[model samples]
Target: MIRLVIIGSGNVAQHLIQAFQKSLVQVVARHPETLHSLPISCPVVTSMNEIADAEVYVLAVSDHAIAALGHEIPGTGKLVVHTSGATGMHVLPKHHRSGVLYPLQTFTKGKPLDYSTIPFCLEADKKEDYLLLEQLARTVSSAIFSIDEQQRLALHLAAVFVCNFTNHLYQLGADLCAEHGVSFEVLKPLILETAAKVQTLTPTQAQTGPALRGDTATLERHQSMLTQPYPKEIYQLLTQSIIDHVQKL
Candidate 1:
């Protein structure tokens, strides 16, 4: 069994704790309320002093907290890893063997994740340690990758563009729909279809609409319909981007 201790109680931490609850896993949180927030039934404690011996220590705290909170872990030569996409693995305390085990997925509080489908990006200081981390990752996920710190940083940036930025655009779409007295639900099908198309076709290949066709009349019509400055700016920017992209193609 892969014995491990998870530090932190945020969305990522709670999800990890839940995913490995059936395995040999323990949890340590700095705040008792954070631990209580989850319906976890593991060996949970709120003090670093109460941390038990484990083969691995997974830090699932925020990016800024990883470096500072890492000091709290006892550096007993145990393998340590953080669950961050953007932070470097070197941020962990030097006393312990450190690595990165970033799950390249957006996490939501109190939501269950499909562990089998989630991709786990792992990195370790030693080749043998990499295998160990892989073994633990395999228990929860099938899609495991050996990603170095630099490559992981690049992937994190891409994730922000595709996930975070795209989600913000989704919010903008909903707001626009609301302004027109249309239910956001009416756009759900188009949104899902757009997402589904990318699975089978490259985004460039799946591209359509007035922007792709360089229909200036339709583009102007869209811009004129948007009375809000932000939406108007975004529409013009994206429409121009699409046209520019197609021109390159």
Candidate 2:
């Protein structure tokens, strides 16, 4: 069994911890503070000093914390890896072998994920290190990709636009529908179809609307119905982007 010590116990840590445990990897220790209020069932430590030896130490902390603790973690020729999407593998402690094991998906505590379907973007300096990381990731995910630093950054940004920004748009749609005494569920089919089309079409190509058709009248009326803070500029900007896409087509 590969002895795995996960540094942080947040959502990403929790998910990874459970996954590692289920895969029969020995979870050596986790940071107590990272566990926070979550009732996580694992051996935890408040500091790195108390930790026993492990084959791998996973730094699942925030981007900022990775660099700080990168130097603090003791070296055992153990694989030191971070779960950061944008941060390079070299950001970890220099004495220990370093790598990345970023799972390109949003996570929430207790929300189950099918790891086998999730893409694990991996990177490492040495061939053996890369192979080791790849094998560990493959223990759960079948969709592991040997992505370099730059591509991982791009994938991360794309996720932000698709997941975070799209959810914000959904929230706005629900609020607007509520104000008009319309059921938000009415938008469910449209939302589902939009997501479905993306699996078939590039987001840019799948784009459709009054903006793409240059249907100014509908755009104006829709803009009129929207109130305060986010309507005018966002509508004009996104619509112009869609118009640009259509023109390119």
What is the lDDT, from 0 to 100, of the residue 243 in candidate 2?
78
How much is 167 displaced in model 2, in angstroms?
A: 1.1
Candidate 2 has which clashing residue pairs, if any? none
What lDDT is reached at residue 94 by model 2? Answer: 74
* lDDT of each residue in 12-34, candidate 2, tens digit only: 87788767763333333344554
Clash number for every model? Answer: 0, 0
Off by over 4 Å in 1: 37-39
> For model 1, what is the C-alpha lDDT against the true structure?
0.86
Question: Where does model 2 exceed 4 Å of error?
Answer: 23-42
lDDT per residue for candidate 1 within 193-241, as digits (tens), equals 9899998999998999998887889888988898988889989888888
TM-score of each prediction:
0.94, 0.88
